[model samples]
Target chain A: MKFAFLILLTASMALAVDKIKLVSTTTDLAWAAQQVAGVHAEVRSLLNGTENPHFVDTVPEFIRLVGEAHIVCLVGMELEIGWMPKVLSRSGNAQVQPGGKGYCEVGSAVTPLEKPTGAIDRSMGDIHPAGNPHFWLSPKALAQASTAIRDALVRVDPQHLADYTKNQQALAKSLEDLHQKNMARLAPALAKLKGPAVIEYHKEFTYFFDAYGIKSFGSIEEKPGIPPSAGRIAEIAVAAQSAGVKLTLAGEYAPSKTLERFSELSGIKAERLATSIQPKGKNKGYIEFQNSLVETVLAALSLN
Target chain B: MLKNRSLLILFSLVCFSQAARPEAAGTGLQISVAGDIVGNFLGTADNRLLPREGEVVLYAPIDQTWDGALNLAAHNEDGEYKFEIHELTIGSSRLIPRSRFKVGQYFLGVGRLNQTHRHDWPFTSAPKVQTQFLYEEGVNDTGAEYSYLWPTPFYLDLTLGITNGWTFGHTHDEGKGPVLPTHYLRLVTYNDLFLDGGLQTGLNYLGRKDSSGNNTSLFGLDLTAKWREAQTLTFLFQSELWYRIYSPAAGDVENTIGFYAYPQYGFSPSWSLGVRVDGYSVLNSKDAGGNNVGSFDYGLVPTFSYKASEFSTIRASYGVKGRLSQGAVSNTEHFLELQAVFILGSHPAHDF
Candidate 1:
């Protein structure tokens, strides 16, 4: 009887612990939320890391997650404009609805880059009028996002404010340490590649390129979302060849055929890079994913 | 004059109250405009090229929990421009937990295709079954709806709605002071079948009294399965089945059944192919008073589409339709259609 009583007591206590239900639009945001919330939250991402964030489908499972969540963290800046709005509207969760206290837009924590100064339209190639939303690739920007997410947690659960703040600080320190370590190791190579022009398959790598001091030559796609015409491909090939661009990077989710054709035409080495942490592999954590990306870029440039 | 002034003041106060409350103004206010333009070539006995449809949609957030939208559409009707309101709705999801309420003129949630806009359809033409039962433009009614999300481990949603008994192509006693309201119920569930694949299914029921003191009831079921492999390929299969019963004041019930199936495959980022099969039949040949009414119609459509960008697409489709009266030989009709669609401005993403 004593042993049974003890087991029942422990189970009840476990159930009594109120964990905040958290939902994020992307795997990166979900990782950040988990890091900050620690044991006090349950985090789920709508899209797996392997999928492209911009073209996510608003599946019903996403709505169910949002409907039950106490808070929702998103990269924002219209990065999920294609599907997040519909999911939020259909979720019927007032607490996480836009403008709700539980709605946490981590992107707002950082100053965006590549904001257009002119009138915008589809002619601009599916550009985000709010600016570049790929800031998660930058360690400094991610640190800011963590702080924002921590603050949001405090707002929703003040009882655990201290815990959230402490976790957030720890995450920031770790990120800083990782960034410094990578920068130190790549300092010589980065110096050599400074202002060195490179080609990208899409506009997805602008933030990363800017952070590492690499100049973007041109994109394989004629426009942001538009496919490249043969003439356009030929034009870019000539431009890249003349510019001495040695490396071409494409996201893992980009069309492989296009990347292969671009490489054949431009005579530049093409590399596929992960846009997010692989959900179920060696690069599962944010730090590990960043390390792999930096290492890959360095190797592609023949700097390692 | 005094009453009018009082009503205006009341309306202003309501608006001001919503604007002043920070919580109510959630996420701040946003306004966006979107438009769809289509050019179509219709091939029939009289082959003609025409500018099909131009639609402008406006979305505005009144507050955090409340939003308003208006859809203005212009279509070429017999070489003349006809402008009309496609949808106008004010929706709120904050009144109840895991629930939403929408009121105004909008598409009825009877089936999957009824709630979808023409521009978003994968095929170039509307399915024959849908057009026959809900009219050419689809079923739109002035009404209010409340939908709730069930707190289950899986994805389950239930919706209940009430609307004015005004189905398109049917005229009842419109000038009457009041009539029986149409009632609708819908239950939807979703499941993740495998990696990168999902299945969603729904059941629906609708009951209402027509203008002629007749009872009309409809039962429907819908299923959709989708699979996507990154940016390389995607496949979708969807089907809807509907059965309707109409009972006159002094006759036996009349029964009709309709169904449609659509399958689409995207081979690349810019290219897709789709096929649709539609069929409908009136099951009852005689009423209690012994009236002949049985008929059947069927159609097949195949489409190939190319997307230029996120905002533009071109599609070519071929359709074969057959109509069979109770005592006449089946008459077949064939048509070829080509369409170009372009969207501009900020358009919200559609549901999967």
Candidate 2:
């Protein structure tokens, strides 16, 4: 009983620590937030790593978490397009609103892919209309997101600025060192590849391809987010055959049917690629996700 | 003048509250209240047979998991009736599985021969046979059912269960209990075909036991080929064969056999048109009611249904019973129905 009292006192003191309560929209942000906040903050990600971030429900439990968060971070290049606006208004937390200091967007500080060049329409199946928000699939993209979060944390609580800086510097150095090693190992294979364009099931690999001086010929999705039309698949089959594009990287969550149809039509083998680290077996986290990308690109080169 | 001033004050209060608490304005709480604001402008003379006709359905789902749900509704037939607690236990794991069980008047697993709600005859008429043996297999029940959804490319859902069999929307006196044995088994399947087409198949079984240990059974099967994005050709064949043995009610019990089949087509996204010809017999109830009611009977039911979206549907169906039609009493008045559907607290949102 006496020991229990001492434990309770310690626990209360720990809970009373100067806390920055954070709610991350996705696992990557949760991971990035931890890099800066360390033990000085409490962090939680609203979405499961396996679920499509765009389709997260406005569950009551989710609302309660958002209500208590001192800060909220999201990959803002329209990744959370359908969810953020509604959740923000419903959160009743002015500190985490769009223009507030607590609202930190990961992508505004980093570049986005396939930004809409014109006005939007709804024929597209749930495209963000702003830009592809899947930029965190690359190491550089992950580092860029951390930098943005660091800047935002600096604004929110200047008292913890030094601590945040030290954390960011340590994280950045380790990330750069790992990225260099992987690049060195992968440089030879990337140079040997003579493919005209890479093919993918979804529009998730543009940043990964761009980092390695590669170009994606087209997406198997006849339209963005829309399942491939029969005629479109037939057309792509012919183009792929002629263009000698042998690499088809299937997104971790893409339908197997689409990949099968593409493979059967094009006579090219397809490779499965992880979009996020999840479900235990697949590579997870920002770093592991980036490293696993080399296999698909290499597979296409090997086929050639 | 007094009313106008009150209205002005109310409207101002609304605006002032919204502005003052903008952050909390759009925050909708988990518990919400919604119902169909129904308007029945067009009515037939037959509808006048009822003193009143309007229903307000109220539902509260346990959560997004759909692990449990309770629904209540007031259908003012005589005055109004309550929709007692309807429970459904949904499972994500394979060992135990998903199920929809209720201890109130509810729908049975048979209508799932066609899972789309709009496909039911006249949109809301859930087969007369279902009502004969059981007042409703479509609303609430005083029984429990266990369902298994097999993890396969072919989406096959299997269900089996036992219930209290009484259908007054709730369980009543023990003496009133028929000790009616209720057992139900059903299966439905779907498979991807070609570039566009798909296949659907279904089967069902139901057995009832009396207090004296007498038992009756019903069985069925259905299949369909969906070729286009919104079109399907379906074929159905069902037989209700019963073993008329072991009843102490000393009345000359007889074995019965019934069969049914049909082919139908869906013409548009919102409209499905079909025709069904079916027949059934009883182990005992002969032509006692009227009109050459042979143990074997059949009917050609041509149906037209429209599902507006995932949430609402309308249907109209008509049929002519032949001479051999079982339960043949008189030419019945058909129906055209409009129904609104809403998945409460938790519904699985399909992701691409």
Candidate 3:
């Protein structure tokens, strides 16, 4: 009789568990979430700043994290396309998968860009048919991300509603200030340059580059993700030479020669832009990345 | 060449990685690698191509979610002639109608290395007969598999694969437009070690070939035992025997048996030593001839594996082999090999 009573007490305590501990795929997302939830939730991103956000995997640790979490927030629209299915299925975390109340897609309501128009298939290279899934890079998109995520948190912790609102407001205010500062810093270039241009692989920077008045004329690939051909390179070189464009964008995975050839032909400078920031040693937070992307693009554009 | 190869691999990784589905799987990406080096082929100049090497698949679960996954994987070595999607299976569990089905490109039913992942591999080499009969690595097909597991971890994995029986040449089917043999069935059970053999956990596999007319069969029995904590010893015995009545490549009815036995002791987590003896031959085949060969080998493989951190590992091994079966040895050869595998991102618990 005493053991039975003890078991009932333990089960009650388990049922009352409230804190929703989470592990994100990228450090930037984790840090941003931390800024909002702080002590209300324990958050960790699986990859350091160097890993690719689009391809992070949820192995045992990730599986365990999801199992322990009350709600899972993900960058949806096929961003984490390949691995998310495997991890969620193995994790047995119904709340975190699509269609579940606990499943939180940060950008579900945000309007997207670069969405695939034709029939989707692998022959077309890495295509995100849901449009540019890197919505976090744009401040407006971030605003939308906050709304969707806050709703998710509210569902997870109704009693802690006040706490969630406070953290979210603080994060939103900080973002507003940063957005204003970035716009001001970028105005000089936005006004002075006839047109700032770049060559990109994936259309990842559409929001950031567009917001800052930077123009990307063409991508390295003739089609999305396909390697640039000799003919395409020659054409881009001639066009860049004519437009006085001086900067070329390079993802960490791009071939060195492609960047070099662009420089040799069009006299443009290539800069390595980190598209994803994982949470780890080198990249402590997303703020560092924001300043870096702006400064790098500015410096590259200024050179031309 | 390696640098160039890495760039190409990275390119394909980025390109093919674009495959994404509805967000639901999980958060975080992971990659893992496991391979081997022949004992006699170590400590020599011709070590570029060792026992075998393969791609370490990359997956991001958190961002993509279930139903959605970003798989970027390719062989790191060379693309002279290789398949694009080798380890392309995805983990998925869903209710279709009233039944549950798992869909992915899995090597199920009856191939060594098909169901056994490298990280979970217990032996250094696969069965000799299968390796001898097949030239390509991972003779797997692109297929959708449905597996049903009773409350027991025991499982009945069924697969329906579509492709040319042989994975060779540019034309997979040479205008055959896929083939007649479209599906293979596999049944396996893990109840206990021989119903109750304190010695080990037992698993057996029975796979029906793609066609009903021709049958290719394989049976595997494995055991691993730790005799005493004092010595900390382990013994592994595996035999993969095949009886295939039809194979376009062999052009004959055949029966083949291959076996590998390895016994080792762990001095510590970072160090260990072991001896392996392996051999295979075509016991019965219509085309059996001088080409149908078998060999017996005795070798010593010393390994040093260190976990740099929770996310990474560095393992090095040195092995020496001697030909115990006179002419069975392909050639009196001495070789040296080195491998460096580092995985960063989300990963399963370290079983190395």
Candidate 4:
């Protein structure tokens, strides 16, 4: 009986040491969590690359995943505003509730852009009054988010603190290396496109544009979440043409007609850029996803 | 007029009290404000265009585990302005494990549509069945609600509640004080469906007693299914059925049944079209003398909505209603309505 009890205890401990379940609201955060947790955690994202994070539905799967999660990471700043509240409320998991020790808002670790001032209303469109939440597009911001995830994981699973720290450091190093290599490859193009004016379909690419030192002339949409009205589109197109903007950028998920209209009116080339790492296929990881974004931007600007 | 003035003062006091609190700016304190305005063009006997209704809602989080909200509305009825407090509720999730406790006056958890705010309804107006059977506003009551999240692999939520039976068509005098309590229970489940869609179903029950010792019970069943492919298109199908039984002191038991079904298709992020069909009927209803007083009403509504942004929406709808009351010939009524809803401040997102 004593031997059997010892064996049972050992087996339970072994199971306890298995991968901690980490759930993230967005694909980018899931990738960062996976990197920081390494083999110590199993990471899953509530949203897919093709789905718009802003409009995710609170499905049953989200509740199930959150209920089993040891930690939940979110972009925060109300990026998941439309569905995260319902998901968390229904999850019934105290560990991932707001203000819980296992809950992490990765956006809080980095300074955000486009924070509104004064009284804000719907006339300004669907804006995150807190700030723009596209910080994952910035490598610096992503590194900070990874570090935050590491700290959160350590708090939830202290036994794997050393491994989390080492993995985070390795991720930071690889990101830095990739950044340097991209800078070298895009130097000539970057020099030519220094503060070059460009038009975009939405406000989602602010962080990426800021990181690459590109000047945003304007967006096709009059406001953040509103579809482009014909009058507003014409107005923006004329402005872009007058400003000598040569390229228009749109997220791969943006409405094709809006991009096409903006490009046609402005006499500029339109390029659809990937917003997140695809769950399947070649662009399945964070590194490849970020690299593709950099290469796409470089190629688009080089043509100009 | 006096009551309306008092309510306005109370509303202002609540707003000012929230504003004066220093903790209102503290972390985890989220406040959201939204407003709805409607304009109607009646093609019936009135045959005139006029501003219909206006409503405002305030939602504030007192802490990480507690939140409160107040809704006030004003509407024109035959050129007279009527004002009322639609809802005032405070909710807390820390009282019980895996449960939420809500207190004060709010929409009763009797049906899916009953809990939804008026401005949030897919159609421009309330369904005829709801208006005929459950009041035009749909079963708002002063209550305490407790919802428990069951420990199941799937999403299953159980809610139990008790409320003052005054608002449930029960006659009560002031001296009577609290006569009877309305009891409510609901079971809700959510599941994933094909094509990246979701299905949610709920069963609800409500039991109440009148000051005259009469008993009334209501049963509701609702289902909602939604499908979306990226931002381009979305499809939604929702249906709800309600049945009620009333036992008076003298007359035989009466039964009332009603249902509404809504199906919507969003061709783009900005445009959506939907239709709603509603039907209600009463059987064996009688007055104190036991004379038959049964009636039936049905309506069909078609709506088109434009979403200007995440926080703003414009909707236009046309409705046709047919009614057959006891001892009267059936008549048809038609009306057109346009509504605009806007959200300001920090509003938490709703569920699918």
Candidate 5:
């Protein structure tokens, strides 16, 4: 009789301490969710830092992770449209399905940039018609996303509403401060750049450049997500030189040789930046990620 | 005063219209199409260029609880185009706890390659074993399936399904229904091999009774493993082994076993090389003297692929098959095949 009572007591304790499980499609969102849900929820991310969010393998492990989640946070606006739908459909978890209380799309908080205004098709090379979904690069956008994620958490765990709300306020303040500090530091460098500041490999840095008041003249690839021909590269080099572009920037995953040839033709330096934070590596959080981007761009422009 | 009242009423009408809108943004039919064009040299080939298979798929959520898909497929046969309804399924993962179900017509969850669309296959062609035991592509029929994932330390999934067995294999003509419907059970498990690697394995069983009172039972084992570094696949290995028992109402019961093994290595993000070996055997056969003999055959194929992007791929393969009769080589055939696959829009993610 004593042993039975002990077993019953242990089971009740376990149930009482059960934590909410949250799954995010990207690492940045996972970091934000962890900040707000601290000690009250378990947060997991699907992709590590290095992967291209556009094309992801629909691995079985994702299904398992999402199946046990109370909330599934994703960067919406077609950023994860390729694989997230498949994962959600196979998860067999009703709570996280679309229209459910736990289906959280944090991207809805931000007003996206470069949203297509007219009819668009594949001729443009795998474009997201809704907008550029890489809004996390901008500190202001990430703060908005954090607020949206906080609301989602409260809907699922109303008992912890005050805690989440207070945490979100702190996070938003920190991000705003970081944004102001970086802009002030980069103000002198921004004044020195010519008509157009940089030439990028893809449109990944649109929000980043906008935040810092940097003007981008062109992209190495004539079309997004498509490898450009040598002729196209040569044309871009001529146009960039005439436009007085100062630097070329690309993600590490881009073709190194192409960037090298473009740099040679344009007589400008090229810099490769980490597109996302490496939680397990050097850049461990969102703040480090933003700092790395600013430092890399400064060094590339010979301003630091 | 009258003009003011008219303006207020118009404003309320506009507000009511906007509020009454029921459909959410971005909820529309997702349409995708894929096609495969193949050319064979050093063997009997088609007179002209023709697509091996062209498929158009439409999918959308029926409501908050259900989603539906319709697949229309066309292929060239005997220098003519034939169109058919490949699959039409309505499914939902939210209907039960840790469980999902789909009803209508779909490919059975059996071996590794059976459930995957052929256009999405890494290689150019199906194996000899798969073609002999199953259809050249796969077996698709009207079916209902229930899949459940058990709460365990590791990933374990169980699937139970039943299909109307009107006919077996690929056929153009409608036939009489079978005496018993096809039933299948599959159990799959997955494990992380390393930080960037995963391995999935499954065991499957399918059985049916034909109109002639003959029973056919198939048992299958499949394994798939992949390892990636820096967002590029470095190694992939897929294999499947199947054994079939054919019990005739009046005759000696026969059995057949077959297997295919494929291993691929990625040279770069856009380039990969792979080789596939196929082995098959009939356990019981009769010679001219009515002696119980066995026949075995094997094929070797090496393929290379270059993916221009997610929407297009180009592949080339060389294959050679050898048939063994009574411990003696009977015949050999060789072929060089080239294939191109393209996707037009919103391609669904392939299952792993």
Candidate 6:
């Protein structure tokens, strides 16, 4: 009878554990959620740092994670349109569906850059219908996103609202400190550069560029999400060289061969940096991820 | 009794109106149009260039707990264009906890490929097993399905459904009412093999009893495994096997078995190559005169595809059908086909 009582007590305790299970579609969002939820929740990311957030494959593990989650943080703005909907619909977790108490779209908190004004279609090559979804690269945007996540957590677990609000404020302060430090250091170095500061592989670095007051000549791919032809590549290389572009930047997940060939042809240094926070290894947290990317860009421009 | 019935009707109308109110402001209809144009070669004279199929789908959020969709499909039939209402569904996953419910017409989820639209198929040709056991486009009927995800350590899902059985396969007739409707149950499970790799398997059973007491039952098993990297599918292996038993009211009972296996490799982000082998056999079948009428047919198809972007694809496939009798195999027919599929507007996301 004593042994059975112990077993029942353990089962009840397990059931009573009130840890919110939060699942985010991207690692950066997961990092922000972790900061807001802290010890009161378990945060997991569906996509690691290296995966392309635009075209993730809906794996079974993702479904299981979402199905068990009390809250799901979406980058939204169509960044995960190719896969997240499928996972959400199949997860059968109504609590995390759109408009539910636990459904949070972090991207909705920020006014994104490059919102297309006029008519848009596939001729633009896989353009996001809403706007650029790389707002996490900006500290101000990330702070706003953290607030959204905190609101979602409070809605789901009202008893811990104070904890969430406190954590969110702490995170916002740290993000602001980090942003000011980077801006102070980067402003002088960027002012010393000649002509455009960089050329990017895609528009993923738009927020980063905007945050640092950097000027980007253009993208390697003339049409977003489409591979550049040989002629197109040559044209961009020549134009970048003539325009005195200092560096070309891309996410590490991009094809290395393309970056190298462009660098060789244009005589501009190339740097591929991490765009998402890693689950492990270096650059594990959001702050570290931002710092590493900034350092890489500065080093590529010979200003580090 | 009449007063009670009238009150119940009024209450239902009020409930439906509340449930169907627009969920949010500025929400409008989402429409998607896709088409498949095919060119046939190395075949008979009748096999000329034609548009394979076109589909127009519209979706809207009815309210917080409900959504609706309509799919209109058109295809070329015997040098003429034929159109049909492919699917119309009202679905909700938030009405209940850990469960989803859908009512109206839809493509039956019997196998992996059955639920997927043909334009999204990896290959340009349909496998013999799919065409023989099911229809070329699988089966679509007015039905209601309820899916539940069991709470477990791994991913396990169960779906049960029933559909009107007036006519099976592709038919245009408004047939008489059936004595028994078609009912199906499917169980799905999966395992994570490695990073970015997943293997999913499903088992399905469907049965129907016609007005004439003729009974039909089917069993199916399907598997799909895919390994991918950023925007690149590295490898994929998919297969489906099925068994059918048909017991007529008077004639002899017949059994049919079929299967298809496809393995594909992606050499680059935009290009892929794959081959499919499929075969089906009928056992203990008889003609109208009561003579033995058992037969077997098999097909081999090899295909290649180039994806320009998410919006378009160009695929070429060669298929050859053969028959094995006694101790020799005889080739019966062959065709080389090419298809281009393009999508416009906001297409719905496909399930894994």
How much lDDT does each candidate structure score?
Answer: 0.79, 0.56, 0.54, 0.78, 0.84, 0.84
Comparing 1 with 3 on TM-score, the higher-scoring candidate is 1
Where is the poorest 10-residue window by lDDT in model 3 chain B? Answer: B227-236
In the range B39-116, model 4's lDDT, one tens digit per residue, is: 767755454545555555666567767778777666666686566676789986544557777899888876777887
What's the CA error at residue B230 for candidate 3, in Å? 45
Please write out the lDDT profile of model 1 over residues B1-352, one tens digit for every residue: 6456546644644564455444654433333333344444343444765766776666667665588877766666667656566778998887688888889988877678787777777776667657766665677778998999999999999989887765543222243322466788899999888767899999999787766678778898999888877653488888989888988878678798998899999988789898999889889876567777677788888989888765778888888888778677477777888777777655677877
Q: TM-score of chain A for candidate 2?
A: 0.88
Q: Give RMSD to native, each candidate.
A: 5.1, 14.1, 15.2, 4.0, 8.1, 6.1
The chain A TM-scores for the candidates, taken one by one, are 0.93, 0.88, 0.86, 0.91, 0.93, 0.94
Query: For candidate 1 chain B, which ten residues in a row score worst on lDDT?
Result: B169-178
Model 2 residue B230 CA deviation in Å = 22
- Lowest-lDDT window of 10 residues in candidate 5 chain A? A273-282
State the lDDT at A175 in candidate 1: 82
Question: In model 5, what lDDT does residue A98 have?
Answer: 86
DockQ of 1: 0.71
DockQ of each: 0.71, 0.03, 0.03, 0.48, 0.44, 0.67
Candidate closest to the true structure, highest TM-score: 6
Worst 10 residues of 1 chain A by lDDT: A188-197
The digit string of per-residue lDDT tens for model 5 on A138-159 reads: 9898899998889889999999
lDDT of 6 by residue, B234-294 (tens): 8989999999998888977889899989999997789999999888888766777887766
Candidate ordering by TM-score (highest first): 6, 5, 1, 4, 3, 2
Question: Going through the candidates in order, what fraction of the true interface contacts does each contain?
Answer: 0.78, 0.00, 0.04, 0.42, 0.52, 0.64
User: What is the DockQ score of candidate 3, to 2 decimals?
Assistant: 0.03
True contacts kept of 4: 0.42
Residues B55-106, candidate 3, lDDT per residue (tens digit)? 4556543323334233333333342433245535554443431122334543
Residue-level lDDT tens digits of model 4 in A1-304 = 9999999999988876687989998888898898889888889888888787877777766876786788899999988877887777666666777777788988888888889887775667777878998888877778877888998899899998999999999988887787777667666776675445577788877887777666788688888867878899888888888887777878777888878887888888888877888878756887788778777666666642
Q: Lowest summed-lDDT stretch of 10 residues in model 5 chain B? A: B16-25
